[model samples]
Target chain A: MPAPMPDISRQYQRREQLTMLALAFPALLMILLLVVLPVGWLAWQSIWHDGFTLENYRRILAEDIYWRSFALTFEISLTVTVLAVLLGYPIAYAASIVSRGWSIVILALVVLPFWTSVLVRAYAWLALLQRTGVINQLLRQLGLIDAPLALVHNTFGTVVATLHILLPFMVLPLYATMQKIPRDLLQAGASLGAGPVLTFWQIFLPLSLPGVLAGCTLVFVLSLGFYITPELLGGGRTVMVSMLVSRNVELYDQWGAASAVGVVLLLAVAAIFFVVSRFVPLDRVLGQR
Target chain B: MVRIVAQPSATQRGRPLDKGGESVDIRSASKHYDAVRALDNVSLNVAPREFVSLLGPSGSGKTTLLGILGGFIPPSSGSIHFGDRDVTLLPPHKRDIGVVFQNYALFPHMSVGENVAFPLRARQLPKADWPDKVRAALAMVGLAGYESRGISQLSGGQRQRVALARAMIFEPRLILMDEPLSALDKQLREAMQIELRELHKRIGATIIYVTHDQREALTMSDRVAILKDGKLVQIDKPQRLHDHPADSFVASFIGEASLLPVRRADACSVVLGPAILRSTRPVPDGDELMLAVHSEKLLIDDGAGDAARNRLTGKVTDVVYQGESLRVFLQLADGTSLSLRQPSHYEAARRIPPLGGELTVTLHPEDTIVVPKARP
Candidate 1:
């Protein structure tokens, strides 16, 4: 008598599912067009040249200079990440525990360097670290040294500049994680007869591991593809994978070799991410949880 | 001038306490935050193995006093003695007191066994003895097999047991609990209160518990201290506190009492709503006084020959039907409101007067408590 009901509830559920998918369609389309397309094209260029050939990849593996560049790139990234973490952890901890106004001021200072261009920052480091620069002049006047130290135009210059740029990346996530930790846990540890150092080790440090992992992953991944700082500060003395790739394209006009280097670096980054995600959940490493 | 009824010593219970129990004495302790005084000059003494509760409303300095005793917050002035040592400047870890925080504060990263063993590790106890101690402590809280479980996987009640186990694992001479049951549901809180009381009796550790719930303080403590603003208003055994509160504020806070303003008739009597009420306790000297009549102490008078000395005639204003009891509200001739609680099955409840119907009630002289109005 009521026209057989028409399964109204089931029909409503179907409409809701359609609405959810419709809402997500734009993001999916953007990912497909922007990210998947470019990456697929890059892979295609690396493997296919005058029909299908693996010669570009073979050249990379056979060359000692390319291998040296890869090694130098990894060494610089690892050193910069370690230094950033060692220096950033205390700054983040101090910011998290201070008064609200002071915390804001500290965070602002950490983010201040990000406003300057990478090229500008690299050049600024050159001025401070060059021979007869401020540091060398001060040391010579103070009689701490007789000759100027070779501070710039090497791996040391590249690392010092990169560390300055990436330190905020490390400190921000650490501060977010440390601020979320409840103060009661520390008090509980103290009440259980733990001194300050023990409390920090057992309670505070373990809780903040997720932030450390996140900061390291971000700095390492970003450093793997870094070009501007290393190119300017390296002064042709310290070569990295990105510099080699760029030289191949500019000097030899070898698009295949450049594409091959890009594919190799991408695969290396993916492998490292897989290994890290296996040990710690990717969401936790990103501080998403 | 109210007579102070001396409470029987806790030792009179005829049970010897465990060896680790220690007495605590806080002498004139005070704390100031910038200009605001969080804790005024307050002194209290707790016997070894005796359980005392600091009971108050929010911002009443109960937590501040607990912090001072725990050595987490230094007092502005005064000293604290555990047994005989003055621990005025000692840090919290050196004080060797176990604290169960309000949130339980179990480490989310560690397993339940590791959390319980944390105190043992801090004290650097023998490694060989840790397993047994951890298991024993977990078993004490009825969480015998939960040692390996993750803290996040447990429910609120289970987490609370884990916290209790961790606090007691060290067997510290003193243990402090800050509203430990406030987060649990009502039924679970009541069950934990009973279990905690049994645990205290078995362990014989002096416990300084802080809570805002009056019923919890009454059910769990040997003595309950009431605080108002930054001062201790009154401290006494639960029964004595309920029976003879020292001021109107204490009377209203500890139990359900309708404080009717009264004029002191003499040294031992007061006039309440056209009735002269005599009290066995002397009248307190103050500009303002109130007759603190407990709701449960009022009885319906049927003009019996053995009537109580104090009587009042009133009209039934409202009747609140609780499952087990009925709250009968009355408006006296002087327009003061009084509440009386009677069992649902009582004879008077069966024939409860209709709204606005006349009724008469009696109050026993011993139950007629008079207290000075709290100083504003």
Candidate 2:
């Protein structure tokens, strides 16, 4: 025997929903203006020439140069991602195990490079790697070479420069994940009669896999659309998808062709994300779990 | 007492491996970090299949001693032996001792079966032997058929059982436990304590357990080693430790005992205030002495009390009802506080005098415990 209360809770919930919507308005608007509009325009320009056409898309499929550019981009990105993992994993492991002060120094070295502009870092590499550059001069002085080696303007130069640029992306996530693994687990492994090497192989490697996937995903995806480092260091020898899109737009003034290539690149990136997410949860790779 | 089962059958149920029980002898073990001594020169001997507990407060170096035994931290100077083999300088993996760390430390990425099979794999046991061995180990810890359960899909108590199963699966003779029950709730902790004691008997492993809980040590250990400030204060059976502490610190640490300052009157007696308290054992040699008053040892003195009992008179300060027992606090004439517990049943509750009333209590000579006062 209590009196029926007024049904104001539903009304209050509606008001709360409105408040949340208002708070989210700015970010939603930014996405619409920055991302949706440009992509929509690209899609529009790719299909519409005078009225509507699939000619530009068909041309990309029929052409060998465009196919070669796509193949080269995948090959270079795969190489860089593999190399970044090999190099970055040891650096992250070192940073994870060292004392606090020394770890700070190591992390700082990784991050300090990240703070500088990609252009400046690429230029620094160019200075050291060019013909008669510091490396070549040193090798010549040491009597190790008769002539300067071709270190730039090829697949080698493109990979080295891109790896330098994207290494922090691979390392920061890996370091964060490695740091979260408890030190007690190593001791527990030892007490369970596992030697250091066996423990590392069975326990540590399996636990840090999320980081490896995350680093590889980031490095590979970023390398696919990479333009600046390859453009500067490759000297037109290595042409990626981004460089092809630029050539269609800036050099040939083919807006339809450029838009088609941009759409394909966007879809490829999306496909990669979908496939990776299917295998491993994205939140875990991002270390949210 | 090392019992080895030669390849347990696949269908065997509740059969834990009877292996890896070896006598441990630690002679003058010490660990020094810079100028601070984590463990002073301490020697201890543990027999095969015996369960010994190292009980102490934090910073008492109980952990450091366990570390020395487990080969995690090398002793600054000492020799340690497992049976006849000297293993003082051996690494942890080579020592062949099971260790249950605080917080369990189970592998997060592994299922229960994989975790239990890790030690066997490290020893390079045949692949076909794993399923049966893992099943046996899991069955021993009361988690039969839990081989496929992920680590995250377990409660705290379940995780503890999994840790124990994984540690004992390889049948190491000696097991080192560092506060393994600390993470469980009170009810679970008590239950696990009993379970662990029974498990020890079944497995026949020499267990060196470290805990700060007096009740846990008393309830489970065949012998308890009490430590304070990196020094071994006393090591004895639970009853001996409670009834005959080596000094004031052990008496206070091991049970609910209120220490009263007294002066030695003779070889068998001590003078407290105006009352001369006599003991069955000779008084310890010391300039200062303390009488340990266990709450349950004191009885209300009637006129017909036995002549062998010593009597003391005090004013009731307070009476506290504690479900099954009533705690009565009394103040002596010289302001020393004494406490005793009485049954809280109807008749006893009615007999308890009002607060501030005079009460006389008697203590038998055998129940009286006196020790040399410890240095602060």
Candidate 3:
């Protein structure tokens, strides 16, 4: 018997391999069917618009209404991304350097609103930004404005609401990245005679850019597809791609146009991701694949 | 037949050398957390250009003390002086100390050249000299051509060298290294330790090194301070601490010691398991002691006459055939197992003793360090 069939250990190894694959295969199949397949079908529906006519692409590229919504979404997303970066940077920096207990408290507070419904956030903004809302009332009472100052139902309201919802996404990754940076680099910079502010700008800022890029990308991509925030806050005055696409599907029942708009949004997000990946290695930027 | 009250100071014997050297003085410093003391009235002085290593185990407050000096943390109570300035209250950035972390903390985003040039550029040194200084610092660490390499491209040893270059770039009056070479492999660690010691000597800059590794501390420091339980147990030249440790902790911690239990008989004298040792320091009346017999201090043989200073018969329990030395574990007649490290090159007609075989080992009284045992 040639080595007695390679001993019992080999049989045990084969059994273990089969056990691991059996346990993992079901979960893998579920993810692929529910998530990945839907995205692939969406992409195919966007491009294969009946006999490959290319009419949907032509309509998206040629139509003013479609381009206008795309432009509006781009502008709004870029603005929200900047505002989120500004607001999130300090919160992340504070979280990284403060005591562990304080950081935990702050991080919890930042993430607390995420647990609430996005519809609730949008409606809350709607109540606050209406023509006769509390802000206008307060401003009128303070005599800053004799009449209501048109605070609600516009691009301004949409951007504000989107940023409020997306702020945590921006802050968490930046904070996690900041936590990995050793305090010694700051000390080293300071020891060499860089003042606190200079040290922060020269050493801390450059080192934290990967996180900054990551946060901005997250906020921008998320903001681009914001449907409820724009619809509830802007009230159709500020029509973004998501609102336009929804109006086509629900009100007009235009499946082909809606699918084309979806495709446009997908391309926009993909393009941004490609541009980001070109400049920053995604692994290093987000600290992992 | 000995007196040990510090040998009568001739010129304020313990007074630090005052003949013009940079001085770092922590005056009666203490750090407390609520009620527990992390540092208890600790004070130390480092002369300019002196390489002082703080050797201690975990929770010895060595890191706490280093943090206070590095300005990362402030002492709960005390003042720190650098030569003539009172900087105890200053924040880390204002302290002007170069620090090499145990992790080496090189910025992954920047190139090695950029990392080294970081300190110089931060200092706002003459713009023209920045490149030269960075190149020189990198070259000093044998990394002259590795300036532009990514942090990921460098090995662990190269990363350590880059950290050294960054720490030395600004040429701060003092550099605080927190176990800089602890991350490398054993062979690389030895090589880096030798290079770092040579760098310290060549630069003639004050360095306060910290490590739990006793061999690294002893080999690299001009003076080694042994700390235990948040207290400075002893501070002296490496050889002195090796030959005459202040207590059993230092004796056992600094190197391999048999540490056979002993009882004090009188000043300068103690009784081991079956041997008596006369020491340079006085043995207290109530002090129980142990002997720190260095493994290398004993010579073992199978057939030896009464030619050695002191002899004990023991059976060999184990033998490790190291390339340079044969470490033999010996069990004494009283049944305590001790180790003897003999040179591998030691030639003899008798075959090496096998396991469980009995042999007599010889040691001198002075070689058996009589250390005072610590009180519970």
Winner by TM-score: 1
Write model 3 residue lDDT over A48-137, tens digit each, in one string.
755666677788899898888899999999999999999999999999999999999999999999999999989888778786887888
Candidate 3: DockQ?
A: 0.54
What's the lDDT for residue B111 in model 3?
Answer: 94
Which of candidates 1 and 3 is the stronger one according to TM-score? 1
Query: What digit string (tens of lDDT, one per residue) describes model 2 on residues B145-254?
Result: 99999999999999999999999998889999999999999999999999999788777899999999999999999999988888888889999999999999999998
| Candidate 3 lDDT tens digits, B322-346 | 8888888888777778888877775
Candidate 2 chain B: worst-modelled 10 consecutive residues by lDDT = B3-12
Question: Top model by DockQ, which number?
Answer: 1
iRMS per model, in Å, is: 0.6, 0.7, 2.1
Pairs in clash, predicted candidate 3 = none
Q: Which stretches of candidate 2 lie over 4 Å from their true place?
A: A1-26, A48-50, A252-256, B1-13, B315-318
Q: lDDT tens string, model 1, B1-376?
A: 3622223442333223344577999999999999998999999999988899999999999999999988889999999999998998999999988899999999999999999999999999999998888888887888888889999899999999999999988888899999999999999999999999978877778999999999999999999999989899999999999988988999999889999999999998998877899888888887699889899998888677455468888999999999898999999988999999898886868667899998888888888999989886
Candidate with more favorable, higher lDDT: 2 or 3: 2
Task: Show the lowest summed lDDT stretch of 10 residues, model 1 chain B.
Answer: B5-14
lDDT of 1 at B18: 47
List lDDT for all candidates, in order: 0.90, 0.91, 0.82
